[model samples]
Target: MGKPISGSAADNSDVSFGLTLMAIAVLIAPLIDIFSKLAIATIPSGQITAIRFTLQVLFILPVVALRGALFDLTWKKTALHALRGVLLVATMLSFITTLKVMEVADAIAIFFVEPIILTILGSIFLKETIGWRRYTACGVGFFGAMLVVQPSMQEVGLIALLPIVSAFTLAVFLLVTRLVAQSEDPWSMQFHAGIWGALFSAALLYFGEGTGSDVFDPVVPDALSLVYVLGVGVAATISGVLGVYAYRAAPASVLAPLQYLEIVSATLFGWLVFNDLPDALKWLGISIIITSGLYIIWREHRLNKTAGTAPVSPAI
Candidate 1:
């Protein structure tokens, strides 16, 4: 949400400060889920997703206007963005469903499998080369995912599969993001993402109504629900912006590891808010996923170092 820092010492200080701020921003995500769950007590999931992105688009309108990035969209990039928008909406809806049904920690741990999915897709679609070390990293990351998901457990619900699917969808979104980033300005890409995501979700809200389905509870929207919706919008926006800034400020190697913090934070939040403590198997799964994620990062670092090239794109 703040301006990205530049070359001055003071700016470097600001960058350091922003790193901490980004971690706090990451925490806001789980808090958003906490709020959304509370809101879902009175609002439908479709309506909530729609409202979340509606407010996000509204929030971005002024910036898109001020920067004059509104007209930057062209037909060439339109299709790609539209595809990404569809995937993004799917991830949002599915992740929210998982958030409603599972502990935030478990959901996020499963979602951390994104890097593995992304790397695999990279080699297949993007033709990015993969090495043994990176393959090993992928293995470790999936192991960690298993630790969190613990599919074999008696209490584990089949619905938990949604988060893994959501993670794969998100990985596709990231792959598209990387492809688009080379040709499109970040603001323009973000603008398209927000606008299209909102439109897609809005259509779902419309159809839900058409089917005589309940959309909103018609209860008086209290301050808490309003706060949660507003927070979801604002927090999501902050994460997007700060994520861009973090990449600019430091190498992906430095910032990529910081993402693991989200898992720890979510685990803590899950325990504190939902009393969803992880058993030994879940703990093992979480450990495996985290290790795999880090291993991928490390493998990327090693490859880049040996090849004498810069770091690879950091996947979310």
Candidate 2:
């Protein structure tokens, strides 16, 4: 209704801070893949998933307590949180399993499809208006993912498809998160998700034990394995916290595209740590995925602007 304040000075600070934090979160996020890749050499991917959640709870517990919201949850919120936890397990298990054989950058590139999947699901479940353009972007994005998957599947067999599963599961997790996020404290939401994830994953590890399954069988962590698993938890905790605060500081449209930076981080880490690199075709696929994803973000921002609304920041 009124003229907006000038953004050339004061308004830039919060947005700038948010961008910086998001960049840091992006840069560090691949460390989770690095650790999972390392630890999965000896430990099962499911085991790594379990350790990550357990460590996340430990890492986040004090913060939740300090915020005086550790006990602030209702049955409904708890149930939703539990659902988030299950989806998180599915997401992480799929991701870590892929990390067992796939390059971190390639795996991350495929996972970028999550945003596109989210757009589709939002149209379906939220009954949000969607135009054909966004739908086209989603289709193109999947084509890019197929490019990445083509070579990966040839090299790694069906293991390459796991990131798609991860993406879909995470998309569902974010949907569940959307249901209760406005009514819950962010820290408590994270803490409760961690609690439920730890419980469910551990239970899975229990039931899946001794089935002779590489994905589900228990492998007790040795001393060095302990460090690797802790690394997974620590990286996840730090990136998660930074992301929460980043959204608090800036709008989703401004910060969403920056998430692609994780691919860069993952590629670099994969090279430095594991000597993995994407081939020329894989590079092309990665570029397409990033470009298509950015187009979707820009399209949504434009639509939200035309409608006089803000883009909803995702909590996943």
Q: What TM-score, over all chains together, does every model reach?
A: 0.85, 0.93
Q: Which tens-of-lDDT digit does each residue in 25-136 have in candidate 2? A: 8888889889888999999988888888888888888888999999998888878999999988888889889888889999999988998888888889988788999899
lDDT of each: 0.69, 0.84
Error of 2 at 186 (Å): 0.5
- Name the TM-score of candidate 1: 0.85
Mark the regions of model 2 whose C-alpha exceeds 4 Å error after superposition. 1-8, 305-316
Tens-place lDDT per residue, model 1, 1-316, is 9886556877667668656655655655566666566666666666777777787677777787898888787787888888877887787777676666677777777877877887888889978889887887787777677666665334557767877788788778877877788877777777777778778888887666646444422234677878877777776776666666666665556566667777777778778877887778887887887777777777777777311111111111
**TM-score of model 2 relative to the true fold?**
0.93
**Model 1 C-alpha lDDT versus the unseen true structure:** 0.69
Best by TM-score: 2
As for model 2, its CA RMSD to the true structure in angstroms is 4.0
Question: Considering only N, C-alpha and C atoms within 3 Å, which residue pairs clash in candidate 1?
Answer: 140-292, 141-292, 144-288, 144-289, 147-285, 148-285, 148-286
Question: Where's the lowest-lDDT run of ten residues in candidate 1?
Answer: 307-316
